[model samples]
Target chain A: MSPRDPSPGAVGLGRRRFLKTATAAGISMALAPLRSAYGQAGAPGDAINVALVGLGAQGRVLMDAMLKIPGVRFVAVCDIWPYARTYGQRYLKKNGFEVRAYENHQDMLEKERDVHAVIVASPDFWHAPITNDCLRAGHHVYCEKMMSNTIEGARSMVRTMKETGKLLQIGHQRRSNPRYLVARNRLLGEAHLLGRITAVNGQWNRAVSADLGWPNHTAMTPELLQRYGFADMHQFRNWRWFKKYGGGPLSDLGAHQIDIFNWFLDTTPSTVIGSGGRDYYEGHEWLDNAMVIYEYRLPDGMARAFYQVQTTTSAGGGYFEQFMGTEGTLRMSENPKYTTINREAAAPPWDPWVSRHFLAPQKAPAKSDDDSSGGSEKVDARETAELAGYYLPVILTKAIHQPHLENFFNAVRGKGALNCPADEAFKSEMAVFKAIEAVESRSLVTCQPSDFTA
Target chain B: MTESTNTQSDCGPTLGVLLLRAWLGVRAVLTGIEKFSDTRTLQVPLLDAAGKPDSSGAVVEVTQKFYSLHSYHAIPDSMKDKFAQEPLLPSLLTTSYYAVLGWALIALGIAVLLGLWTRASLFLMGLLYVSLTVGLILIKQDAGVAWLAIHVALIAVALSLCRHNRFTLTRS
Candidate 1:
């Protein structure tokens, strides 16, 4: 397909419409009174003034949440795009905030003296530079996920964060998610619920068409091409398809799943082995679908874990994790649902002890009044409450991001530890780095401690 | 009257056949270079396991400097190791080979698009692609698989048009 194809135009139009609707809603929300805001008041000594760099889609969402967060004020906004800058300014103005605006983050940091925290929501390539500047400037940071575009960049961020003694929270919000937290507590914390985890399976699958909004065969200027990270701006915008700027699905979506595996298992994979390519999509450079497998060994050496992620024609919406253990299996996802299937405690048919134990008194199995034929069983309120409480604040509540931001603010106030620190982010990034290497090499890629060094 | 009209139409060529003939004529004109140039030979530096140039670190250093000037995915460590073992060309020469090949491919792709020397460019690209693919396969490198696929596809398209040389102008 040529670069000038109309499909991208159609997609862009759809996106623009969505953005228009979102922008209108944001304007209305901003105009609402501060007293009625989600979070409007702060405790004594809890004041946190924040400056946002890169007011893109995710950036605006975080900003909206911050405005609603009590004790937090939006002090400054920065963006390379004029539209984003104007939208952010309007939102802030409506919220009664005299937000200082800048075309660049460096200028914003230099000018905004009262800013206690900076949020780095720029592109993958810009994360390290912006984060380093923010840390060195003595401001706590809440940088978005996929910490950096490269392994070296992630390492440097970690080192700089450590040297500055400032709070640096990596935005892997799933770490703060109540559903995942409950799953973690049940599978990892409770031993009997799922006996010594032997293996883990996880997947995040989605279906997307091949068109990315841009003209095919578009003549690219040297400067424009360089800015886009390639001679093809079409590939640049649809970066997941290219190798220069993005690492395809392995780095984009796989990072989250890998982070979950690492978090629950308390170990990074010993090695990652996988293969993927753009098999279905014609004329696209990036892989449309991929499958990866990672082998992890727990510190105790008692269990092994495996993780996989695929993005292709979706047979169905898939986002779940299965933990296989000796006694029972636990399946969980962000849907706030988990199942524990208990296996009967008995000797195997092949075991010699089965013959010997057969003569012993065989107690009748316990019976329940509830229907057993149906697979679905009602969970007691107390059990559900325990699972829900596993996540900080509560489950089934839209406060995950709020509490995560709250944690960052508390860390800045020296009252709490960061939920996802730079070191942890580096570890997560290392896993992603290995995954990319593994896919490229078609061989198992291992991560050593030295790999984390800047 | 109908018979006379059919006879006249048969005597005169259709636009589709005329275009095909013209395309074949152009393809025949550009194939002259393939007969003269020896394009089968492949040249690449040998590297050892550590990815250091086999002969010395000089080639590796030169390659690194060249890469710094024009950024490409860093040569995989495995490729470096292969270079160390084969050492087909010195580091400077190897770097020059890449520079020349990259420019040549770009030129050829443009030429093919313009239907200027289409056959010659396609043959040259095909040879380069084949040589590179063989070298990578021999060295057990996975880096160039995508490029190999693209080169093969382009060569097939160019070869399929060998019967026609009538070039279509952008406006025409």
Candidate 2:
């Protein structure tokens, strides 16, 4: 018999007790820093033994980050196809790292019992099951984002993370990047720099590209391919476009920006409405282009945010999130090149902010002498302010992945909390999947507090 | 608006400090460019004892300019003997390393010249100069002390002027 999707019920209850448990876990770890926190076997030189499940694209990126970091050792790698495993193993071996390779994750997990953590980089559908099995086996996990393809499966991850009390870091690496931390914690949280953020806009636009490809390798037997639910190499390579395996571009790409929208706002969106279809890719199960709008009810009043994901062309711009407030607007992107903070012309001057080093000041572009509006048109005293655009400082300079990987490894070693924990990531899943549902239902979907109730 | 002026004023680095920033930034640019393109500047003080801008002076790489006082020919036989004994003679001179350092100098120089993230730019540049001093010390090079002293003084001036970074492209 073929394996079916695991039951979400296997992991029970997502009560509010996580905070208390997490706090207790923190205190206990603080008490004993040298030892492992999750009652697992420790590694020599304080290095953590990490096993990876999928050696796909992101999996390789994580492996590269691991190679750079001092403490992470790749003990085992598992992949259904031979290419990923062979490439990863050869690359690591060349780098003087010795690791065992496996075709089945269960075998990898069983053989590498000493592994302190597991990084699940499989397809969306396998996220929950693999994470669930790892958590049950007492290994900490750093699963990539989109906790699972379905909300139910996503919820199961949250439940298992809570029940097992093991650290489950979802790969929203942005949360761990110091730039985002400073923007969220220092600028928005402490300084309230973008005073009373009233609206937000986000988008991730990707230029059209060729469908995913596989290296020229001897094909696996038909049964071997079917065992993993792939009918052919094309489906295996391009699984993200299939409905049965993954959410379309919205969940694939929009989840990250949508997660930021939810995060920077500090509230779960109350309503979502979106629309799109595979207008370009006729056979694609997921929408090649999607636009989702979310309404967030903030403490000050109701706030709204809009998000769009397009695969046709990146003509407009790349991915970024902009939070607009009465005083100014803060725009951030992973690329330091695009990040900027623009001030409202009429709003209170940002001198104090600049003085406090809360913001880096940029000069408004010099107006051309041919400018029409510089006239001394003594307009009304109250309405004299005009908006001017100036850029904010860009401080990020290092590779982006290293910081988050450090966070996860450090969290495992009792240093700090996971920057993007499962509970936090599931919040984004609700927003993203519901937005996908919104596109299908073609109506405004109201989200209740219970939607995030786990 | 007081906001506009104060915001501008916040970036008000002093004239002396700005000059220092520009000098260091331009030095980094030149140094970075000489790494791959000109590289002939390392022999200026040797071929032209007046330290005039000969092709050698125009092409000195960061390490060669800061160390190995002689052009490879100018080094005395005694020091050349020490060079043979020493292991790993400053590996930061790689092509990729120079390229990145050049781009960084250009970026930081532009940032300081514009008063954009002035503190970080000045702090990093100062830090880099100090690090170069340390690297020179590690390699037992008596050279670079004068440039280090000037850079150290500039770093101090940068700190003093950083709090008031006005008359530049960016602030704070």
Candidate 3:
């Protein structure tokens, strides 16, 4: 049948209408608040006073994204390092923003009373404290992910937000990515194109790299390092690999993609088994490579997802999540090139979706040499046609983190709901926390459903 | 055998030349035609669960291929962007070249097919291939350069056997 033809049956027609309605609803629901948030031109009363708490690498990234958003003004910048403080202050000033700089977040809060929202881009160890303090100080917060270095710390941030009745958004930016939203909500959730998903695999691998270095002239004094909970500048700069400051690669990289497993499945893992080692880099306290397997007990049937984060080599197809089912598979990544959907030969035809322009079929495979040469060859009875892939017809042209930050800002303005609220991210973080535990104990860690609750 | 049949069989080189002319002419014409093609999305009414067109005004986007002046200009403008930064290529020259490239390909392709000034058409086609090779080489596109080289080679063979040309737009 031609692509424009409606499906032959009532059920198919029902699905088509439902797909259209749901897609339209989802787009309006997602776009309406964002449009309101972005349309404001920073007029006097509409402007939101904002503060940045950490001016390091992640802090600079968040600052750049927030700068593009409308109706937000930076009033203060804070960081323990004078080097970063200078960078953030200068960068913002160049963008027509002049803000006070401080070496401490509390000091900034005390001086900048009008600040409406604070962005916590500090290290994992400091995320909870900074976010909690900002919330208690009557300011909404947008904190970077791996919510906190510890489960108790993550829970405290959630509890504090509840007590203060403030907005707390976690930086799982993929949660707000339009491409991901369409794939998860429309294709998988509404269309049910991937049939019964039974298995998943994901990875984030990196090539070996040397530790970060700092300018000798900008180095902090020993006394300053001691007060800020760092052994030295090395510990402060390379905090992600240390035990006291971070949860290693699993929390640093795995948290982003693993959170999607929970979000897409709408359930936390029941058990986590892990294996890892800190073998590559010397003086680093955390594992260099970690592999984890999480088992989910859904209402229908059990499913499993395997995840890994390796800092030694980027050999395995960059980073992406693959969901395999009887009908099809979805390979998703923040990188658009790594994302696609493939349908099994046994699955029903997807002409309706193609007709609706929801999915675009890729080029068909060339005929095999045996068939082309007209040679008589017996085909194996078990052989099936190759799975054909379709490209998701969506793309994100802006900075990857911009949408999530916009979502946070909109929530702060009471115009929209937080995409990655503290409570929801806390649940996903529990899986990573347990996977880390499984790594330490070298055993499978079983988690009760209650374990995910903050 | 009949005299007409003998005449046809004796001119094997003419048949070879005809085959090459047809292949090149069709390829060029089709490539030019595709430059005018583009995909446009339109919202169409959706069918409800009962397989009847919905009255709720709900619609889904349907993309269809269209031929228009906008696509013809846009395709060349896109190619100009790719060639913009090549040190050996000037922006003005690239722009002018692209403006006429599609039409020139179609006209030349037809002239060769109809044996209208076949010698001049084949020579200009070869020159076009040569210019494309230079552009591809400057952009460090090895595969495109190789493909253009093969086209130039075919044109060279066709020109060498123009003596066997039997068809023309006017009497010989």
Candidate 4:
């Protein structure tokens, strides 16, 4: 067979089958409002002490978000890069926090006993190990998603979290965003906007971009690169493109959106079929574009969701997900600009929904197909029915990452439940890995219940 | 000879109407899909289910910036704050107007081609064009004002002719 053909025969028979052992699916949020927790980290006025591991791009973003949360305080920062280490310390000191700096995470863990929690923003390869170490050291961990590059690594984190009894919240930040909480919990879960959701579709199309560059002032020595399994500075900075260090673009990008598929459906996929190629970017280990379909068996019938991420062009639009059902479709992006609930023609009148606070009572769409009124001509009802879609407001004004971090800190203090906890995050990991497998294999991969179990 | 003569005479307009219907039908369907698929209307930085925009939405952001960049160039220096916001309210209003207009054109063309309620389709096409003309004239922009008037005139003529058409899905 040609190397171009992608077909996964079995999990243990080949590397594709080996992926079957990987962990995680679904984002079953414990529906409870958070109470202020974590006064124990400091006095009533003092912020809870937190340390950060992996001073990469996501690490920096998380640090900024952590600073914004009222109760959390950055106490230590660690990275393999000497410049990054000092940069973290300097940045924190500039912000009035006396942060301890460490070139190694183990050193940070051993030294910073006062830290109440740790945020693991390491590359995909290191997520499990670093998060596990932090949990072992008695600090709650908020690790970034796609739990690890490997399902085994992801599963190990879940096992470690379970063993330690520490709060291990995975960084699927959408779980924490209030607008999504309203969309998912209030609208879908409570009100059932998209009644009996039968299908889902989503895409994340990014414009062409150059290879990522590292910000460290000094390049890593060949020995250091060898130690970290990187070929050079480029590989270190762009670890996401590598097979060993990252889950490529599929696990990196698709993990976020597919988790929503699992979130809205409240079920792990039974099968995933995908097709993709590295057509756009050359010399990358990961595919540049991947399209995957996941089959989720609902109680009444089978529902399907299609997810695609293309790095070559942003021709059509930005990333958004739509849940379609018998009644209506609820589509939302991060911005309020695209969030809306569109009713189907056969769906019930939406005005009653307004009283339920699910929809904003706007004009009942003056341009309906029903009445030619006194003198004007009437349009067809079906076409005008599409116009009756309602837009939601920009209700959540806080930056996106803040709420998840807040939830993690709150969970650490025993005040709130973890939204994207290890068990839930792992389902997404399994689903993501399965999709990546299907794309590479060029075959329909059936997911057994065993596939989701670690 | 009589049957053959009658058949030849009837075939001409029937084929013409069918051909015309296909042309208008395909054009309307494709344009409707285009409107539904337009990048600006799609809205994003495709966020995570958790509502994070890490994946997409840069196109909208860049376009918004471009709008602001142009407005900053054209507007008075005294109103720099208002101008800096870019894609001002007028532009937003114009976008909404065009979105609705795209849908109506699509609906009008499809209904007319399919002969689905001829009177309503022709009237709607005319109403849409007239509304668009008024909106464009209100904006006072030279860019597409002339085209809007042409559309209005063409729709007006089509509406008048539609009054006498015998071929339709539903007869008056």
Q: Which candidate number maximizes TM-score? A: 3
For residues A1-454, write the lDDT of model 2, one tens digit per residue: 1334555344432223544554577745332431345444656666888898898998988888888888788888888888888988998899877999999777777777688889889988888888988887778899988888889888888888777667889988888776677678657886677778888998888888888876676567678878887777777888899987888788888888888998888889999998898788756678889888899999999888989989998647778999999887888899866788877766777775554344555545666436699654557887645555544342444467777888888878877667788988888889888899899999999998888867
User: What are the per-residue Cα lDDT tens digits for candidate 3 across B1-172?
Assistant: 6999988886998888888888888877777778788898765555444566533223454568999877885245545666887777987888788888888888888888888888898899889879888887876778778998888888888888888877777433
Give lDDT for model 3.
Answer: 0.81
C-alpha displacement of A308 in model 4, angstroms?
Answer: 0.4
- Candidate 4 on A289-362: residue-level lDDT in tens? 98989899998688999998998986457778888888888887776766778877787677654543445633
Q: Which ten residues in a row have the lowest lDDT in candidate 2 chain A?
A: A29-38
RMSD list, candidates in order: 29.6, 18.3, 12.8, 17.5
Clashes of each: 34, 16, 0, 15
Candidate 2 Cα deviation (angstroms), residue B161: 38
Please say which candidate is ahead in lDDT: 3 or 4.
3
Deviating ranges (above 4 Å) for candidate 4: A1-46, A214-217, A361-387, B1-172
Every model's DockQ, to 2 decimals?
A: 0.00, 0.02, 0.09, 0.02
Native contacts recovered, in order, as a fraction for each? 0.00, 0.00, 0.07, 0.00
lDDT of 3 by residue, A76-148 (tens): 9999999899999999999999999998877787888778889999888888878887776767889999988
Question: Which candidate number maximizes DockQ?
Answer: 3
The CAPRI quality class of candidate 3 comes to incorrect
The alpha-carbon lDDT assigned to residue A190 of candidate 4 equals 62
Q: Model 2 chain B — which ten-residue stretch has the worst lDDT?
A: B55-64
